[model samples]
Target: MKRIVPLLFLLVAAASLPAEKTAWAFRTGINLTPGLVYNRVWDPGYNGSALTVMSLRQNGGFILGGGIEAGYNYTGFNLHFPLRAGLTVAGGDSLTLSANLDLMPGLILGIPASYFLFALEASMEAVWQVSPCLGISLSAGPRYTVSPGYGEAVSPLEFIDLTVGLAAVMGN
Candidate 1:
């Protein structure tokens, strides 16, 4: 009777414990970024040039956390360090969706020159959990950057970036 009573108590205790929720995850991936440059600009008007810059990118992020990206620029290299915040918009056993914003400060290095870059980005992400520790993610975002132009003054550039990622999730 004592053994049965103790077993029952253990079962009750286990049942009373709250299930853990996923509050954190880490993602890493490769991204392709193609940016369009403006040749002339007026207030609320822009004459976009056909010039485009393509970059090969490597990125990492922490959920509700921070982000870092390194890119091989067409001429040299660039680094973006961003502060990020996000929330899960929806979720179930196998999938989740999120929206995130990032404030980034970075450096662009070119041959014999360098420039400071600042940007704001808004992104939407969808993740499919394949296992407890592995997930695949697709993210798309628009980024606006303020940086020095090639020959003129500081200018703003716009980009649409797409990323395919893999993540490790915990506390789910």
Candidate 2:
């Protein structure tokens, strides 16, 4: 009962947010990166993070959404839930360029232990509208992950992730 009440309230509130286009788009992508991941010690490794963003368009230049990403950071697996906002920079019939930011509060689970993770990512993309229902994008971003300690173990604050990836956007 305790869990259900807050969940219901959240659903109602999300449904009430204002949208201009009245149509929603879902963005899905993948990030392939060679960087550093640390738990007890830092190592050079490759981390691939899958991403999705569902955007609700507002009347002006902005759109809002939220989505989750679950992936492997070489040493461990993690889940990232990110809130997204996009701004249309230049738009036309075929091509559009936009800037976006994702604020993520994430959870890491696997190898060494589990800890809390947070990352702020900013990216820019050029989206080519293949059809009214489909588009493809290429994007890159730098993510700074906050590593707060769990239990008595103190985690370092030096998890910087750089990623470049391709995305597919599908909608009406």
Candidate 3:
């Protein structure tokens, strides 16, 4: 399932590409995403009920500030790559300062479906955005906890999180 997800995403991305080549546009928008996040823990030598712990329910919350996006229009769709960083508030007792670096390769289908857009993105986020001057963005995609060191002492932390939030672009 893990391997297949990426393959499917690529297929969708390729199919969405437009036939006509056009100049890229820098776009900025505000979005709100409300979804579920999954949490997991991995221990190298631990076993017997302590080997792995997981939380796969809707217990996580996220908020995006403002973001900027850049992309080109091909055929009739727009292919975009956006970067967003925000705060993550979990339902659990723990509170984490979270940020994500995501490659949101998506298409904004022309009219009729104009107001709607879709994309598949992969992100690598840290505890916070490096620069405060940079704007925040809103995006949705599969989120994975590649490095699990947040709640190390109490649990081995790892998660496949789904997040929805908004971003504000600064420079643009």
In terms of lDDT, which candidate is strongest? 2
**Model 2 root mean square deviation, Cα atoms:** 4.2
lDDT of each: 0.51, 0.67, 0.32
* Tens-place lDDT digits, model 2, residues 33-104: 655564436676665666555443434567566666777764367767777677889889889888888777
Give candidate 3's TM-score.
Answer: 0.25
Q: Cα deviation of 75 in candidate 1 (Å)? A: 5.3
Question: How far is 88's C-alpha from truth in model 3 (Å)?
Answer: 26
Q: Kindly report which residue pairs in candidate 1 clash with one another.
A: none
Candidate 2 lDDT for residue 140 = 79
- For all predicted structures, in order, the TM-scores are 0.60, 0.76, 0.25
Q: What ordering of candidates by lDDT runs from best to worst?
A: 2, 1, 3
Enumerate clash totals for all models, in the order shown: 0, 0, 16
Over the stretch 1-172, how does candidate 3's per-residue lDDT look in tens digits?
3443464455334323343332111224433222233334332221111011111111134322212233322223233333333334322222123444443433343443332233333433222232433334444455333222223323433334344434433331
